[model samples]
Target chain A: MMDPLLHVKNLKKYFPLRKGFLEKEKTYVRAVDDVSFSIRRGNSFGLVGESGSGKTTVARAILRLIEPTEGEVRFEGMDICRSSESEINEMRREMQIIFQDPHSSLNPRKTVFKIVSEPLIIHEGLRGKKLRRRVEELLETVGLKSEHMFRYPHELSGGQKQRVGIARALSLNPKLLILDEPTSALDVSVQAQMLNFLESLQRELDLTYLFISHNLAVIRYTCDTVGVMYLGKIIEMGEAEKVFSMPRHPYTKALVSAVPIPQAEQPETAILLEGDIPSATHIPSGCRFHTRCFEKIGAVCEEREPETYCFPDGSQVNCHLFKSTALDDEAGHGGGSGKPLETKDR
Target chain B: MKPVLEITDLKIEFDTFEGTSHVLDGIHLSLGKKDTLGLVGETGCGKSITAKAILRLLPVPPARLVSGEILFGGEDLLKKSDEEMKEIRGRQIAMVFQDPMTFLNPVFSIEEQLVDVISAHSNRNGSRKEIDRKEAKKKAVALLGEVKIPQPDVRIKSYPHEFSGGMRQRVLIAMALSRSPQVLIADEPTTALDVTIQAQILKLLHELVERHGNSVLLISHDLGVVAKVCRRIAVMYAGSIVENCSTEALFNEPFHPYTQGLLNSILTFSKRKDAAQGIQGGIPDLIHPPSGCRFHPRCSRAMKICEIEKPSPVEAEKNHVVSCHLYPVRKVKSF
Candidate 1:
């Protein structure tokens, strides 16, 4: 709306593969290829995909944890990718990340106080009483008792440890937070608590989040906007409600269908995608989802790559069925299956 | 129909340096022959402990079942001696753990592992002294086939690491079935697997249990997995069965706040368009859990009565049992 707080344009991250004798550079694994999305200030934008979908790569690239092969990352209208070292350091103070694994993300040897205060010490140059007070305040904000500040990571439960992670992220008082599957490891009850805490924290702190998770349910609930990534590309992107209710992309539909309903009698037949997710190194030509595409739209889906078809409602899908050309051609002659391709086959 | 397994008021405690951590607090469960009971809970809820306690496999000294009756076919397993329990472990109740790699030996071939399991069970039953190695190998291959492992014959000779994570889990399931135990305990069997692989394994397990007419205890953090495989669901909290009901009932009108919270937290594709509502507050410290209701600290509708007194098991409806003070129909019990 007002030039999104963070603008990611054509982000691409490729990991080089080395092979044989002299260790010649082999082919590069295009982890995050031509991915672009922006997050509004204080709004949560979710990135959903399976393990190798490059959702994590996009998060890391935006955080500058892993340098992108090519693209532009603008944070608060400042181009982070091209920023000088001093400028980048200055920008780092306003952005932070909370990793998936709480146990590993935290230093096992360090106490909770040290862990949370580490950020403040490095960025704000506060120590001793001031740092301890700040750390306690952060812990209190995350729903942890002030006394828990002295405990080590191992002493705390999975949920408590995640709280410590959250506290550390907030210690820097950052505007943007990148949460990478923050609740995947916790228990359902605990996961619920964490999600609630995150929502409340976002509200109170007015934080912007680039939430990355394989869990569609969490994303559906927490994010204001949603982006579904397949392989290295964003196949679908739109408002959270629009994307969830009316998913246009076949991959998105399959993903949505895959979520398990607690009480309702699921259809005897699930939209079971055959085979494992293909290796990214050897991506199929054309539509990345062609191999598992249940629609089986035939050769066109596997021959020419589809472009993102933007809808008036702000929803976008990169599928052949929605291509403006196809729609226009069909409308002009009233040929082919003039019907808007049924999203759900069954 | 007689239940294949019944556990009554089971309590497990771990002796740690800090103190005796009361892990499993009076957990009671029952499963009819060929029934699938889904044990759903978050991490450290003691869902896995319930399974381990059934097999008497918990590490002693630090781990001890204070009181409970694990009755399999009317036999009180807790009262049974260590030697007696060993006989029941694989022969009557078999288990498939979460991680296949950790459960499987890397050095040994798949065939060797499966054969060893069969041999061990057979030896316990006093089947034969001179075990036929070749015949055992054939049986192992067949077991592999039963679990739907592709290229079973060739794959049987490969080491555990050679197989993918899903395939290895399938191998473990096959090994558990070799004993043909009346009850199968699978603890987060598909957590490490992909969704497609997880679906396949769930289907395979469902078919195996139905065809064999054996009961299964499916333990997992995922309610979706439970919804697919289990006929009945047991919602555990802080080592206690907070809610137990038929799958349909649990999903339709969950009486327990914890169960409702859990169900709401799980996001399904059908409801992907809707926002997910997660439960508030973290789990209480088990060692020093809340005085009354373990879940009271996080319960949205927690009352002063809930904090002061524990609620007894109330028959909320037909086949639905809940432990919460909110339901006026239920009486509060003192801890």
Candidate 2:
């Protein structure tokens, strides 16, 4: 088997909450807790969940943009989570991120040429005409014309701003790019154009992507493997087809079924979860998704936290349903290497 | 079903610094008594403008209605005076906007806002004094419960900031239906909401419309969202109503080139044919759209006629009407 490029093991990020000024009763938000996954070389691994499901937190933790409270982020076999400042700075050159809101991420005052060329100037120390040529080439590569290189972020449309954002991300020629809801802001027509461009760019540049999105359709189109985050925890992770078509965790199934299918009658298998997502500050005791799980059992699911059950394919599901299957086959091959005890934080 | 609201040849323009931008180019649409009519389009396609025009909510200096008549209950709403329009705004028709956060007042409690909405419609016949504070609060509680907001009694005291996006939208829905208006204009009501919350809100709207016998003018950019509740659908492109038909006909057999492009653009869970190809190019600049057909610039099957002259409405099917040169209306047989 080929080596994984990005191995995220048991990543956790907790934000402290202080209610009162006097007593200082502190509680943890548990933004991203116990998320473990590995991206094989040149493959796009997607993280999908609702707004407060902690998808963005996992992405930030992997990039070390926001330092994780616990666990290891091994990039190209080096543990970047605990790396030295200089070592982490070196890793930053290889990994770049394109934020979700282009309107916010890109500097409003910076011109397109300046925005795209700043990375080259800082990283490779290119200046003057050399920097200008590289910036033009980058813009042309992302389907933007050379004329747009002088315009500010505000002057461009939503789609154009996103293209500028892509051009700036690609300027560094990074091996890995984290695209966080890249097309959620654009219209359907513009979103399609952006998505096709991303796919072509991936093949052209041989880039690995950590795609984070809530839209299931976009995730299905872009990702090779998918990780379903629920309330700061990765409830399910597997190949995109396996997870989307036949999701092991109930939360994952509900999410897949929620996306509306076009040119078809109402989906027969629509799993509409009844309640609103609980606040992340006060997460549920046992299973984060047990409150909304369609296939939830009474006692076991609501009591103990489910352990990660690994399949032969290295995909993991944190649910008692798969856990029981493992217990049933405990005698065979000594659990058949289906338990992620080595990587399990719990 | 009796036609409750009708918009005929509705043309509007915005006076920007650059020039006069023609926003809605002769939009023709109608809503039945108890049907959901979805005005679906992409951004900058004049879907929201059409909704705001229906309620006469567009600012006067900026937005000018050049040639159009919004007929509600057989009377032209365009001719209504300011006082008369105010009377008709909340009593006859109510609107639920896109962003629930901004649509609702932050400082006002749920009870205060709902009661204010109830009391503001003072021209509703002799029922003005009948709805006192206590009675209005009771009705607000009942309305909140109808929209499926939990603990209505206690939550009514909480401000809008205390509610989630879904819950805030539900509160807006409750207020929109407070007077039980005949027509409800929901302008992308669930666009800001999550998918799970979106489903719940759509379900709530469906149930409310079913029970109350009201009409919904659902303006949304998403095709699947309006398909969930809308009986009749209209696909708009660059201010023109490209296709209008029953939901089944629109989904099963789309006619216009732009409509076809839109249907193709929807990213399905199943495999995409070839690479995913969307309608090429951004929406046309409304100030000076394409010479003939608005969508001709990006259309795959665009012809010389599509560039030269705009196609009129063609009744391709029993109730389906499309505006395109490709499918000419067949001659009616009288054998």
Candidate 3:
């Protein structure tokens, strides 16, 4: 198969902590460590993780919003990560981002017209009547009218403000859109509207999306391929349906099972992780999920990080249960009580 | 079975500079003794306002009670004096807000706050038990332990910021349970926590309610969260209760269009193939709300009568009720 629209290879981002007055050594917050994924043309690739899991960091790193420590972000065959200044500036035209909170992300003082047209003016140098027409057209595409272009950001409702944000993101007619918790701040009904609009927009524009959200249902609905992150690592990645329906990793199963169904009763069996996610500043040595993973393999998961295990169905999981290799029984990787963990605990 | 709390024809209005915002348009609900009722809705939908009205937490100057009575265990809370309401606030009807940080005093330790609440209720009105700080401390530690807070004895001395978001919410729950109040109103208790921690907190609430036999008014936007803890759910849309029914009936056969819209918006694992759809229009402005049914503008099956006449609650099915013009045959004549 040909390479996907976007290929992110082993991206790493480490934020160095300020050294204390007396201490000589400094610590680093490994925000996004050794993460890799790809989004096919016009397909949304979701990145799901709890807060501090570094999903957002990966998105930012790919866009070069922050200087990534290492790795390559190849966008449409161009290595944006290592590209020259002029090339990156040109690359920015084909890529844009929509933030989670439109209220904060948008300038309160700027009218909807200015907010949406600013991107177009910066990139294409459209002016006056042309710019206004473009802004109105963009607004119309997002289901807003020309009349709304004059209103300030604060005047618009939460949902309407998000529409303006979308219009602005689409001003440049970008091929790839990085949506960071795009619908999280909106209400339930409003979220539905935005999600539908996003779906329609994707189909019409033939855009690729890197949808990042902690909400599993949103990801399940919007994303085609999914990557589940745990402590700055993509522990699982596969087709959205398979990963959600048949999660292999313990953390993935717990996340998948923990999603509340709007039914009367919960499922009988649930893989409830033991504690809160550990702080990212001091990530666990091997398999950061071991601290909370209820199905942890005796001592192997704690000491050695499991290598990526590829299944027959094109799914990848970083878990010991699916550790497909010659293993000596004495090493504890092949514990006698091994259940070959899937969704259920033995 | 008698209701632990009953709210009848409860209407609330907020006087803003633009106009009078009709926040709660005649909310009617009853919590049976030892029952958990979930009041679910989107933001600014009056679910939170209803919760505030129950405790008289809304500021009187800005918020006016247009009409209706809040009856608590056979007595009208609206009629109670300020002094009497004070006694009832913490001891009779305890409340846990959404954010634990804002509700909890950051300056004080958990022990101090928990002990204060315990002692405040124990000594309120006319209780024979003498107020003892030591006993309160002991009870506070026990309450913390009941909520599954680790090292309760040591953790009790820590400040609120020291605990994680989930743990702080558990602390708030512990404080609410500390008084052994007859009614516990948890308003979006787990909204601030992650899905995993939300599960843990939800389990804690269910267990506490079971053990204490306290009626709960669980208000949340997430339908799943409400469904897990509540047996019956009241779906509010634009300051009005559009559907109130058993959790099973609401899930299986939602009568109201708004309720159906909410259910469809959620993409459940089991229903992956079903496409998600939202109500077309935004909520009507409360300042100038629609004449008859607030949801009429967005309803797919809306008729001319829906625009002219407000829908009365109709018995659509067994243990299921809806306020929509679609079910005119089952519409009851009761106010």
Q: Model 1 chain A — which ten-residue stretch has the worst lDDT?
A: A337-346
* Rank ordering of all candidates by TM-score, starting from the highest: 2, 3, 1
**Given the true complex, what DockQ would model 1 score?**
0.41
Q: For residues B270-291, write the lDDT of model 1, one tens digit per residue.
A: 4442345667766766778787
**What TM-score would each prediction reach against the true structure?**
0.87, 0.95, 0.94
TM-score of 1: 0.87
lDDT per residue, candidate 2, A1-346, as tens digits? Answer: 6668888877889998877888667898989888778887688888999899899988888778898999988899999988988998889888989999999999988999889998888889998888899998999999889999999998788888998888888887888999999999888877877888899899999999999999988888888888888888888887787788788788877777776555536655667888889998888877778888778887888888887777655457888888657546543422423233322221
Q: In candidate 1, what fraction of native interface contacts survive?
A: 0.49
Candidate 3 per-residue C-alpha lDDT over A193-227 given as tens digits, one digit per residue, 9 for 90 to 100: 79888998999999999999999988988888899
Candidate lDDT values, in order: 0.83, 0.84, 0.86
Per residue, candidate 1 scores C-alpha lDDT tens digits across A1-346 of: 3667888888899998876669665888989988877787888999999888898888888878788899989998998888887888888879988999998999999999888888788889997888878887888999899889899999898888999999988887899999999989887656766887798889999999999998887888788888999899888888888897888888888777666666647667566666567778878888888988888678998987777665645556788877655456445422223122112111
Tell me the tens digit of each residue's lDDT in model 2 across B1-335. Answer: 65899999999999999899999999889898898999999989999999999888999989998998989999999999988988888788999989999988888898999888876664355655655778778888998999998889999999998899999999988888888899999999988988888877888898999999888999998888888888889999999899999888888888888887788777767755235677778888898889888888898898999999988777777778888988765445333
Instruction: Give the worst 10-residue stretch by lDDT in candidate 2 chain B.
Output: B326-335
- Return whichever of 1 and 3 wins on lDDT: 3
How does model 3 score by TM-score? 0.94
Give the clashing pairs for model 2: none
- Find the candidate with the highest TM-score and give its number: 2
